[model samples]
Target: MANSPQSKKRARQAVRRNDVNKARRSRIRTYLRKVEEAIASGDKAVAQDALKNAQPELMRGVTKGVVHKNTAARKISRLAARVKALG
Candidate 1:
Protein backbone atom coordinates (compact mmCIF):
# COMPACT_ATOMS: atom_id res chain seq x y z
CA MET A 1 0.00 0.00 0.00
CA ALA A 2 2.93 2.31 0.57
CA ASN A 3 3.84 2.94 -3.05
CA SER A 4 6.13 5.90 -2.54
CA PRO A 5 9.58 5.40 -1.02
CA GLN A 6 8.86 8.07 1.55
CA SER A 7 5.62 6.41 2.53
CA LYS A 8 7.37 3.06 2.89
CA LYS A 9 9.98 4.61 5.10
CA ARG A 10 7.30 6.25 7.19
CA ALA A 11 5.50 2.94 7.56
CA ARG A 12 8.66 1.32 8.78
CA GLN A 13 9.25 4.12 11.24
CA ALA A 14 5.69 3.86 12.45
CA VAL A 15 6.09 0.17 13.16
CA ARG A 16 9.18 0.82 15.22
CA ARG A 17 7.58 3.68 17.07
CA ASN A 18 4.53 1.59 17.77
CA ASP A 19 6.62 -1.15 19.35
CA VAL A 20 8.48 1.37 21.47
CA ASN A 21 5.32 3.10 22.58
CA LYS A 22 3.69 -0.20 23.43
CA ALA A 23 6.63 -1.15 25.62
CA ARG A 24 6.56 2.21 27.34
CA ARG A 25 2.86 1.94 27.97
CA SER A 26 3.28 -1.55 29.40
CA ARG A 27 6.09 -0.39 31.66
CA ILE A 28 4.02 2.50 32.91
CA ARG A 29 1.11 0.18 33.62
CA THR A 30 3.37 -2.18 35.56
CA TYR A 31 4.55 0.67 37.75
CA LEU A 32 1.03 1.90 38.31
CA ARG A 33 -0.10 -1.61 39.18
CA LYS A 34 2.61 -1.86 41.79
CA VAL A 35 1.27 1.23 43.44
CA GLU A 36 -2.26 -0.06 43.26
CA GLU A 37 -1.37 -3.40 44.78
CA ALA A 38 0.56 -1.72 47.53
CA ILE A 39 -2.43 0.44 48.27
CA ALA A 40 -4.82 -2.47 48.18
CA SER A 41 -2.68 -4.40 50.60
CA GLY A 42 -3.13 -1.55 53.11
CA ASP A 43 0.57 -1.28 53.80
CA LYS A 44 1.01 2.47 53.97
CA ALA A 45 4.76 2.36 54.07
CA VAL A 46 5.04 0.13 51.03
CA ALA A 47 2.39 2.16 49.27
CA GLN A 48 4.29 5.33 50.00
CA ASP A 49 7.44 3.82 48.62
CA ALA A 50 5.66 2.57 45.54
CA LEU A 51 4.12 5.96 45.00
CA LYS A 52 7.51 7.58 45.29
CA ASN A 53 8.91 5.23 42.67
CA ALA A 54 5.88 5.57 40.38
CA GLN A 55 5.69 9.35 40.44
CA PRO A 56 8.77 9.78 38.31
CA GLU A 57 7.73 6.99 35.94
CA LEU A 58 4.36 8.62 35.43
CA MET A 59 5.94 12.01 34.86
CA ARG A 60 8.39 10.44 32.47
CA GLY A 61 5.46 8.98 30.58
CA VAL A 62 3.99 12.46 30.27
CA THR A 63 7.27 13.95 29.16
CA LYS A 64 7.80 11.14 26.63
CA GLY A 65 4.32 11.76 25.16
CA VAL A 66 2.93 8.40 26.35
CA VAL A 67 0.48 10.17 28.65
CA HIS A 68 -1.00 13.66 29.02
CA LYS A 69 0.39 16.01 31.69
CA ASN A 70 -2.91 16.53 33.47
CA THR A 71 -3.72 12.87 33.31
CA ALA A 72 -0.52 11.99 35.09
CA ALA A 73 -1.06 14.78 37.58
CA ARG A 74 -4.55 13.61 38.35
CA LYS A 75 -3.41 10.03 38.81
CA ILE A 76 -0.62 11.10 41.15
CA SER A 77 -3.02 13.31 43.07
CA ARG A 78 -5.60 10.58 43.52
CA LEU A 79 -3.02 7.99 44.48
CA ALA A 80 -1.47 10.36 46.96
CA ALA A 81 -4.86 11.02 48.49
CA ARG A 82 -5.52 7.31 48.80
CA VAL A 83 -2.13 6.73 50.34
CA LYS A 84 -2.69 9.56 52.76
CA ALA A 85 -6.08 8.22 53.71
CA LEU A 86 -4.37 4.98 54.66
CA GLY A 87 -2.72 6.90 57.46
Candidate 2:
Protein backbone atom coordinates (compact mmCIF):
# COMPACT_ATOMS: atom_id res chain seq x y z
CA MET A 1 0.00 0.00 0.00
CA ALA A 2 1.19 3.45 -0.85
CA ASN A 3 0.91 5.67 2.17
CA SER A 4 2.18 8.95 0.74
CA PRO A 5 0.69 10.91 -2.12
CA GLN A 6 3.87 10.58 -4.14
CA SER A 7 3.95 6.85 -3.66
CA LYS A 8 0.36 6.58 -4.76
CA LYS A 9 1.18 8.56 -7.89
CA ARG A 10 4.09 6.27 -8.57
CA ALA A 11 1.88 3.26 -8.09
CA ARG A 12 -0.60 4.64 -10.58
CA GLN A 13 2.18 5.33 -13.06
CA ALA A 14 3.48 1.83 -12.63
CA VAL A 15 0.11 0.36 -13.44
CA ARG A 16 -0.09 2.41 -16.61
CA ARG A 17 3.42 1.45 -17.61
CA ASN A 18 2.64 -2.17 -16.92
CA ASP A 19 -0.30 -2.11 -19.28
CA VAL A 20 1.76 -0.54 -22.04
CA ASN A 21 4.57 -3.00 -21.54
CA LYS A 22 2.15 -5.89 -21.62
CA ALA A 23 0.75 -4.75 -24.94
CA ARG A 24 4.23 -4.33 -26.33
CA ARG A 25 5.20 -7.80 -25.18
CA SER A 26 2.12 -9.27 -26.79
CA ARG A 27 2.84 -7.53 -30.06
CA ILE A 28 6.42 -8.76 -30.01
CA ARG A 29 5.24 -12.29 -29.35
CA THR A 30 2.83 -12.12 -32.27
CA TYR A 31 5.65 -11.09 -34.53
CA LEU A 32 7.84 -13.87 -33.25
CA ARG A 33 5.03 -16.37 -33.72
CA LYS A 34 4.62 -15.27 -37.31
CA VAL A 35 8.26 -15.96 -37.92
CA GLU A 36 8.04 -19.29 -36.17
CA GLU A 37 5.04 -20.35 -38.18
CA ALA A 38 6.70 -19.32 -41.38
CA ILE A 39 9.80 -21.27 -40.48
CA ALA A 40 7.76 -24.26 -39.42
CA SER A 41 6.02 -24.28 -42.78
CA GLY A 42 9.45 -24.76 -44.38
CA ASP A 43 9.12 -21.76 -46.66
CA LYS A 44 12.34 -19.87 -46.80
CA ALA A 45 10.90 -16.86 -48.55
CA VAL A 46 8.06 -16.41 -46.10
CA ALA A 47 10.32 -17.03 -43.16
CA GLN A 48 12.80 -14.50 -44.40
CA ASP A 49 10.07 -11.94 -44.89
CA ALA A 50 8.65 -12.61 -41.47
CA LEU A 51 12.09 -12.30 -39.95
CA LYS A 52 12.64 -9.07 -41.80
CA ASN A 53 9.42 -7.67 -40.37
CA ALA A 54 10.08 -8.98 -36.88
CA GLN A 55 13.58 -7.63 -36.49
CA PRO A 56 12.60 -3.98 -36.30
CA GLU A 57 9.69 -4.71 -34.02
CA LEU A 58 12.00 -6.62 -31.71
CA MET A 59 14.53 -3.85 -31.76
CA ARG A 60 11.77 -1.38 -31.07
CA GLY A 61 10.77 -3.43 -28.05
CA VAL A 62 14.35 -3.27 -26.85
CA THR A 63 14.50 0.49 -27.33
CA LYS A 64 11.21 0.95 -25.49
CA GLY A 65 12.61 -1.01 -22.53
CA VAL A 66 9.99 -3.71 -22.94
CA VAL A 67 12.66 -6.28 -23.93
CA HIS A 68 16.34 -6.61 -23.09
CA LYS A 69 18.80 -5.77 -25.87
CA ASN A 70 20.83 -8.95 -25.55
CA THR A 71 17.70 -11.06 -25.38
CA ALA A 72 16.41 -9.46 -28.55
CA ALA A 73 19.75 -9.92 -30.23
CA ARG A 74 19.86 -13.56 -29.25
CA LYS A 75 16.38 -14.16 -30.56
CA ILE A 76 17.18 -12.49 -33.85
CA SER A 77 20.37 -14.43 -34.17
CA ARG A 78 18.68 -17.76 -33.51
CA LEU A 79 15.80 -17.01 -35.87
CA ALA A 80 18.14 -15.87 -38.59
CA ALA A 81 20.11 -19.06 -38.23
CA ARG A 82 16.96 -21.14 -38.47
CA VAL A 83 15.86 -19.26 -41.56
CA LYS A 84 19.31 -19.72 -43.05
CA ALA A 85 19.21 -23.42 -42.35
CA LEU A 86 15.76 -23.76 -43.93
CA GLY A 87 17.30 -23.96 -47.36
Q: Which candidate is the best by lDDT?
A: 2
Model 2 alpha-carbon drift over 4 Å, by segment: none
TM-score of each: 0.97, 0.97
Worst 10 residues of 1 by lDDT: 20-29
- Cα lDDT of all candidates, in order? 0.95, 0.99
Tens-digit lDDT track of model 2 for 1-87: 999999999999999999999999999999999999999999999999999999999999999999999999999999999999999
Model 2, position 67: C-alpha lDDT score? 95
* Residue 25 displacement in candidate 2 (angstroms): 0.5
